[model samples]
Target: MRAYHLDAPRLDALRLVDVPQPRPGMGEVLVRLRAASLNYVDLAVATGAFPAALPLIPVADGAGEVMEIGPGVSGLTEGERVIPHFLPDWSAGPLPPLASRRMRGITMPGSLAECAVVPAAGLVPIPSHLSFAEAATLPIAATTAWRAVRTGAVRPGSTVLLLGTGGVSLFALQFAKASGARVIITSSSDAKLDRARALGADETINYAAVPDWDRQVLELTGGAGADLVVETGGAKTFARSLNAAAAEGTVFVIGFLSGGDLEASLFPIILKMLRVIGSNTGSVADLREAVRAIDATGLRPVVDRVHDFADATGAYETLSRGGHFGKIAITLEHGHRAQL
Candidate 1:
């Protein structure tokens, strides 16, 4: 089998090499990977910002077919399609301590290869409606968005404010719309905002044009502000997200694409009686619920770019450029073209 190994922290250290095909052990399943999607955290891993063991196969999200089922794994069989959960330990309910440190790409070998062996407990059946590339985008981005929206307890006709048109924000936009919530999406690019509008974003703000976009959000909501804010921009935008959030609303922290550290006051949080929730990727139950919702709504993940397996490094570079609007996927099967 072929795999990409991060022998060191630099993206240049990511090397493609042949490795022995792994056989499933007790309670584990061997996946013949079809596609894997890159996340911002993947970039962090490549740069050593996220600690990982050396010679690690780095990528947290993948979708493929079950080629072999290990002993004691009864619910899955060979030829069944499945997606690997990013965090193997946090399978359900509240996240357990130290689970993030043990996440697939961070502490364990991930699925950026032709084959991967994953615990059966962390695998979710892929919906029949989605292709491998689409299913590959689910485990991390989609599940995190699911947790964020559900944490906000968004109701019908409520408002959701998304920081950007990235994977998580786009997923949040789609899910919020599915739940009958009005979505307000922000982007520096007008073209991206237009795209968000097409995806059912009730209002789109070019944050670059309107630097005080939170005020625009308040105006759009008749000065009440958004009921939920998916704050992916982190330090650069967290304070504004707090400004744009309605009293008693929730600002779910999912990403730090703009950098993690923030210089902000805690006064708004107290004055507005707001809740700031830090959300990791998600649990297995969360993934299951997201899969059901995607199946029911026929919602498709927004894939920004698809790179051939040989160009995995280029895929990482693309993600680093921050030019992509949604998930960037890499196809692993030889001659298997990714559906962009």
Candidate 2:
């Protein structure tokens, strides 16, 4: 089986090679990957920034068909489409211990392989409404958004502020809209702001024009601040997220796309009595809820670009440029079978 291997924990360690195909153990399933999508985590892992997740294939989320199931596995059949849960053991509620969560491409060999083994419970059935590439983006981005909204208690008539036009932020906008929240999106690009409005955002802010975007957000919400914030941009906008939150509001710190370091003031937190929450990846139940919400709302994953596995290096190059919107996908080769 062909897989991208990290020969050593260096930026240049990534290489394509034919390695032994993985087989499933008891209660595991071997998935024949049809598509895999890139997240910022893939970039960090490839660049050797995260030493904690060393010596593994990069990419945490993917969609594929079940080719085989291991002993004692039930309720899953051959040819069913599925995705790997980022936190397989976390069925619901709060995040599991750091010692226990096994991320697909980070801690373990991820979906970059032609075939990979995962615990059966870690595989969530993909919706028929989505293609392999579309469904591949769900586990991380969509699930994180679902968890953010659910944990932050987003409700109808609530006002929500979303940062950037990235995958998770966009999904957050979609979910907030479906729940009747007035959505406000922030972006450095005006064109992306327009696109976000088309997806039901009530208003848009160009963060570059008004670097103090929190004031703009407050103005949009009549100075009450937003009820919840889908804060995917990291340190560069953390202080702004704090400013954007309403009295007793919630901010879900989910990503650091801008940078990992943040500058924030303690005064607003104490005065407003706000809830500052952080989200990692979500549980299996959250992934299922994401599937349901997307299906119910008729929302589909937007593909900014697609690349075949044979030319994935070109895809990586294009992804590195960083102007694209939505998910970047690579379809896998066919004729691969899973062995349990």
The runs of at least 3 residues in candidate 1 whose Cα sits more than 4 Å from the true structure, single-residue gaps closed, are 99-101
Best candidate, lDDT: 1
Task: Write the residue-wise lDDT of candidate 1 on 1-340 in tens digits.
Answer: 8999999999999999999999999999999999999999999999988777777999999999999999999888789999999987677877788845468777888979999989899999999989899999999999999988899998798899998888999999999999999999999999999899999999999998999999999999999999999998989899999999999999999888778888999998999999999987889899999999999999999998889999999999999988788899999879578664
TM-scores, all candidates, are 0.98, 0.95
lDDT of 1 at 322: 86
Residue-pair clashes per candidate: 0, 1
C-alpha lDDT (0 to 100) for residue 254 of candidate 1: 85
The local distance difference test score of each candidate is 0.91, 0.82
The reply for model 2, stretches above 4 Å from the true place, is 9-11, 334-340
Against the true structure, candidate 2 has what lDDT? 0.82
